[model samples]
Target: MDFTSEKKEAENNKNTTNGNNPQEIVDSSSQLSVADGNNSISKEADEFRERQARDLKAGLHPLKSKFVFWYTRRTPGVRNQTSYEDNIKKIVDFSTVEGFWVCYCHLARPSSLPIPTDLHLFKEGIRPLWEDSANCNGGKWIIRFKKVVSGRFWEDLVLALVGDQLDYGENICGAVLSIRFNEDILSVWNRNASDNQAVMALRDSIKRHLKLPHSYVMEYKPHNASLRDNSSYRNTWLRG
Candidate 1:
């Protein structure tokens, strides 16, 4: 039979199989219709979303996954005091998640270093320099870890930054791990020096998370002065 003839025969058979009432057949078919099907699917989607939200509220830590960018200055060239800085621009372009671990794994640990060097973990657009737009008006909270403890301390601090264990992350521009002869340091860079609330909140959060010792002192300094500008506010800051 032709397409139309076949379709007609099928409908006739369907009605006959039912009560032979066309309206009853239509009503029965309407219950299984695409529009109702779509409504059920939409309801299921909403329920699934609600359940997920509830689970998240019930202390289910949200899975956080994202690219992290880091810069290390302890490369052999910098350690040798070659009077030259690494090509900063090239490092910025190299910032990425996988690149971060690859860079960390291939580099010397902080304890093995003989000079003061810094590893900067910041968002891709941001440069680690104090004068960069994101850093210009910022400050950092300094954490001094003894040189002998550099290995464990460095690993912990780096993990904190990468895993976003710090508070006020929106105001956080980056973090730095500075390797010195007698001490290793970790510092948190904030986007605004005037954001006292965010800065303090971030400090408190970190201290609580790490259960830092009561004697540990954290110092805050604007990035420009940290870069060793003689005339910056930090100079006046120290005198005060």
Candidate 2:
């Protein structure tokens, strides 16, 4: 999952698919911005549309839905919404396969990201915030993995998401990769916590796509529980 190899492969694929020079791909990292509340979301949506239009003209294959990448460096002891909002920064938004690779190639690998850092990939217009209307009634399924395998798992999850490999993809809102001191955690967010069938289907789909071993335990926690406890990874229901 290193950038050099992935970039080369993507470049080759682009050349084969549309006969366009790889140089046409823009570096999306330069577009990173910190959200200034509601206004930022509105502005981002407009920008996303404009960018997608240009990419379409370039012959890139469009994805079913657009997605935004977000990064945040947590303050060790701070857990409030105000502080969290301040730390989160929007990296870029992509609506096509080529755009996704352009963004992904520039991102630091999950294993290399510093402790207390989080990388989020969410559907466009859906902020990663639990308070977002799209997420308020939802929950997430989290899987913890050793640091060494973080990159592979994160990439697999991203591919499955954008490729629409999941049966319950409509229920999915986004995903997060948290790099911590000892382990990396991956969480997939859904739009409805009350939809048991959809939630379980999402979990199954994730396991299948990731080829997750049965030995690994998965935990599900409602956003309401996180709001009450002010913790993202506490008091969860576990499935082995």
Candidate 3:
């Protein structure tokens, strides 16, 4: 329809592609480039050693342990936002142990990011949006965290997801942190909404790892429900 509009929207994505600024240096990849000129040999050896150590520490299925990182700014409707699909492809292309940490280091924490924006990390081949074939018929188990408690909760949740701690880890498509003024929300998407067994398993896994108190409650809602009316889902699932 509007090719010009799409072109302008694509240009706005410059910052997204140029990610990893203000480097946090969390992985060997970032360090390798710095070993320029004379010290390249030593740097290569050090990097090799670091990689071996990482491989040793990697738990079962090291390859699957890797997660893709996606960032969004606090903007309405993601309107005027960067090319999301393109950015996701970029992530998949560059995904590696080093790239994951580098991307994380550069991006703002969910709590620190402006409102309405989100940071999503899903297994490779899985898009963050619910529309992906992997997610189309699925749903998410959402846990709400107050703004004051969001930072550590977010970190723990990320670790839990990437570390493959969820009960139905294979069913887990990805996780999302939706920022809001009052309370931040974390939703772990599963591949099938109708799979009661898998859904229950995932919910229990989250509660166990997160160690939610007896007073706390988690809600599961279908993506279709979310798209139709988030409030209806919340009301039916949430209890005081």
Sort the candidates on TM-score, descending order.
2, 3, 1
Count clashing residue pairs in model 2: 0
What digit string (tens of lDDT, one per residue) describes model 1 on residues 1-240? 012223344443332231221121123342111449789659756765765576567643221222233444344433222232342312222222332343334334556544645556675456666777778898777777887875776666655665567787667776667776667777777899877788788888777766778888777777767666532223323100
Score candidate 1 by lDDT. Answer: 0.55
**Model 2 ranges off by over 4 Å:** 1-57, 238-240
- Worst window of 10 by summed lDDT in candidate 1: 17-26
Q: Give residue 220's lDDT in candidate 3 (0 to 100).
A: 81
Question: Which 10 residues in a row give candidate 3 its minimum summed lDDT?
Answer: 24-33
Candidate 3: residue 169 Cα off by (Å)? 0.7
TM-scores, one per candidate: 0.57, 0.80, 0.65
TM-score of 1: 0.57
| Steric clash pairs (candidate 2) | none
Model 1 spans > 4 angstroms off: 1-103, 227-240
Q: What's the residue-level lDDT of 174 in candidate 2? A: 93
In order, candidate lDDTs are 0.55, 0.79, 0.62
Q: Give the clash total for candidate 1.
A: 0
- Which candidate gets the maximum lDDT versus the true structure? 2
lDDT of 3 by residue, 87-149 (tens): 332233222333434344445555556676566778766777656878989988878888888
